[model samples]
Target: MTLFFLNILLAVIWATLWNSFTLLTLAGGFALGFAALWLARGLLAPHYFRAVPAVLALAGFFIVELVKSCILVARDCIAPRPNIHPAIVRMPLDVRSDAEIFLLANLITLTPGTLTLDVAADRSFLLIHAIYATDEAALVAELKAGMEHRVRKVFGT
Candidate 1:
């Protein structure tokens, strides 16, 4: 019963905020579908009140790093010195779960200048393409420090 209500409430909020569903009928349909899934699967409810603060902290950190990446890219473009140090570094991820690995890869791709190229055959490593690579150590450190750690925390690893 609680999960059903929670799903309906979530659907209503989503419909309201996005304004994609103009008619109450459509909103009710969405709520019903979501409620059915919620009831059938019995997914563990995330404690949103506890998750909100951590989410905000992660968002804030990403914003600061985004700014730094933007500035660096701009400087490299303007310097006329060919500052593009292109390199592919394989970051061996400690995170074993699929969700955590996907989160890490998505985080890498979401950042301004980096691209997640591929995962290893065993899924133990991620191939990341970076425009600036001072060294292997720097690349590894940057990935571990910049994205992976935060994702591990955010996804409750």
Candidate 2:
């Protein structure tokens, strides 16, 4: 009964925030949103205030990385480095949640020259193709240190 009320409350919140009208449309939206929240409630844990600082920190880190990556890509494009080591590295992720892993993969893919090629069958690794890998160890460390750590911090898992 509590879950049902919670679901309805969530639905109402969504509708109120988005300002939807028409009985049919509002009902449909509420049903869909409630169902999604019900299904996803298990995966999304109850982290509240703790996430605020982490989110702010991650946002800052992302902006820095974005700027750095753009500059590097521009430099490489202007002066085609003959020794560019574009390689696919499988980064073993410790993040357990499907949503978190997807977020990380999307972030990597969105970055300048890095592409998220695949996720391993076990969901433990991300296959990423990076254009500027000087050394395997350094590249792996950069991916983990630069982004993965921040992801863990932000998502708290």
Candidate 3:
């Protein structure tokens, strides 16, 4: 994912350095950046390009979840009576690396009404704060089904 982003940034830098903002120039820069990465394949990790598809899918998943969460939060704000049932729950994680764990935590925090508090010392669990969670089990299941599952796919774990 960082490679993907660096590629984009390199493209922008390409355009900026050349003082050409045209779409054609941007595309050319992107192609050149891709070629640069391809040439360094032997020097870099083998799985660099393979993770692009999963990263794109993860991005799409995040957008969908963000929209859904925003609507839910908006409804709560618009309603005549408040129906917020806040809770903190420890969510199990299959992710081991610090990067993957941090990404999961950030994604959870970005979603409305959900905040990641801490990761367990063992890194097997994530403690999250949610504004509306009447049924703790259901909330945990929803999170596991939604965010946790997508995150696992993101890291190919």
Candidate 4:
């Protein structure tokens, strides 16, 4: 946590030194600060170093999935004969913490064709409505492997 704050402080200082506080400047400063922190990883919590990359990876994965889903949705909308096979699937959850479950559910809902309908009271499964769920088992497996896995990685759960 301290390292994260320090990284933000470094970004602010870098912007101040340049007399420019644009978003790009701040982002550049952040990248430089992240590099500096990486160099000093021996002096900090090793978990923090691992977490930063995991979070970035999750973000990257989400972006790719979002784009792919958007394209698929758009194609279906424009098709003469739309082939969407929508279904509500019950996906067994492997992520245990409330925060992890919340993040995973929200990510699934944010994507184009999928919406998280509800989580089981026991938090052991999620009800997901997906536009492309021709095979419920495959859809569940894909989500478990993709978003759920990334969420677990990010939270270290």
What's the true lDDT of residue 79 in model 3? 94
Candidate 4 structure lDDT? 0.93
What tens-digit string does per-residue lDDT give for candidate 4 at 92-124?
999999999999999999999999999999999
Report how far residue 109 has shifted in candidate 3, in Å: 0.9
lDDT of 2 at 98: 89
Instruction: Count backbone overlaps in model 2.
Output: 0
Among these predictions, the greatest lDDT belongs to 4
Model 1 has a clash total of 0
* Residue 127 alpha-carbon offset, candidate 3, angstroms: 1.0
- What lDDT score is found at residue 92 in candidate 2? 88
CA shift of 29, model 4, Å: 1.5
Give the alpha carbon lDDT tens digit for every residue of 1-157 in model 1.
4544665677677677777666775567555656565455545565433344566677888888888888988888789695788888889987878887887788778877788999887888999999888697788887898677777666666
Ordered from best to worst lDDT, the candidate numbers read 4, 3, 2, 1
Tens-digit lDDT track of model 3 for 1-157: 5777878888999999999989998988887887898788887665656566567788998999899989999999999987899999988887889988999899999999999999999999999999988988898888888777777777778
Compared with the true structure, the alpha-carbon lDDT of candidate 2 equals 0.78
Q: Considering every candidate listed, which one attains the maximal TM-score?
A: 4
Off by over 4 Å in 4: none
Model 4 TM: 0.91
How large an RMSD does model 3 have? 3.5
